[model samples]
Target: MTTNAAMQGKAMSVEEEKIQGGVQSLEVGLTVLDALTAHNAPMMLKELSEVLSMHPAKVHRYVVSLIRKGYAQQLTDGRYSLGERAHAFGVNALKRTDMLELSQRYIQDIQQHLNCSIHVSKWFADGAVVVQSLESNHVFNIITRVGSRMPLLKSATGRLHACFQPEHIIRPLLEKEWESSAKPEQYPANWEDFLELKAKILSQGYASVTGDMMAGINAISIPVFNFTQQLDHVITCIGTEDQLPEGQMQQAIDYVLGVQRQIDALFHPAAAI
Candidate 1:
């Protein structure tokens, strides 16, 4: 015979299972919203249904629920688009977006994989400034700190900025750097040489230095662009020549480029979709 206590325990277990699995209706409704968001324009019921691979009637039901919640809306022509509430949500999210915070996990991943120190730099009023640094497990002392300013022509991080940023923005800094450089002969001798160097860096999609910034230290830097395709940040990996040799340069570049693509996708989700 079934006991009353056993029945109640069974009911509780089913309830817990439902909680763990989440509300299916809510999930479906959010999927509808995602379809609209990714579409980035008003979509008809038939179009959205096709995109989600669901029946039109079922898609309309979820769309109705989203409309009631102000996450979506219907136009006079019966096309559906993101609502005012959804726009506000996206605006708020953009306001809170921080490049340094977004790159932290990727930075840690690369440091662990390459066993090399990583530096993240952002352009300040003067030039590229190190905003974040992560040290590898190896016992070498990395001289770059959080507030250190990286040179425009002398460091890999700086060259990356020069490659992507507007010529007007970087030209003054480049001239000043050339004038102030202790070893002027080591850099491009004239404006034509500077242009050629920039062209080469752009062609390769990254900049690199060996025993240039600091004797014994080699570094590679890649640029990260925002949704509007502006230079957002520069990520640099540093190590001794032995740690990152010429033979292994391509491997390190691949790792950094992978992270760069991820960050780019995050900034430009519509393009990614």
Candidate 2:
């Protein structure tokens, strides 16, 4: 009995090292915050613990701490939700960030010069792409905004990221999302088609499609790379068929790619994307 107890105590001691405190607490806190941000509704203690695979006791402690610190609040149903402090922090972070500042200027320039709608997005995770900024000058409008997320398999930006991604990373990510969406409704048909499209998007420096988002509303996209040559962001321009004929699409692409280069320079001086 004594030997078993000692072994159990040693195992727990090792596990406690993984509890995430000291400087790591910030990351743990961010992890919780991120999960909350992704969810549309407030989460119960059990839901949060399940989502993070954290112990309820530990999660409760964090939730209570965040509540006391004004970053979270408890609902009448006892679920934890983001408080005003979270929104204020996010707003201030965006206000001070260079990405949006640079993205906005470039997007506006593209709109003024090309007279089109521009979408700027980043790869937030393996299976979702989030639009961080958008600009439209003509009568038509782009139906995306800051914090809007799109699925990996269906969205143009998502497809670009998938095509540019290294095979090892792309394959696993594809498989993971596929597993999650294997059921009815959202399940993708013809895996072979997806593979073929990804190959084409890779070969073409930019991807262009018409009627993907809406009929007559064509879209073109170019993946921007950071200084390290990693696909860091994407810039997409949208226009109607009447506004951009097939013959003029190449020129439009060149113009947009140039804008992308300028924005890339502004955000990452030495980077291309």
Compare the candidates by lDDT and give the number of the best one: 1
Q: What tens digits encode model 1's per-residue C-alpha lDDT throughout 5-109?
A: 999999999999988999888888888899999997899999999999999999999988888889999999999999988988997886577866787788788
Number of the top TM-score candidate? 1
* lDDT, candidate 2, 146-248, per-residue tens: 6776545655666776777677777777676677764444423445756888777777677776665456777777876644456767777777786666668
Off by over 4 Å in 2: 1-104, 166-192, 261-273
The local distance difference test score of each candidate is: 0.85, 0.72
Error of 2 at 1 (Å): 80
TM-score of each: 0.72, 0.50
Error of 1 at 122 (Å): 0.8
Please give the lDDT score at residue 100 for candidate 1.
Answer: 66
lDDT of 1 at 61: 91
In candidate 2, where is summed lDDT lowest over 10 consecutive residues?
182-191
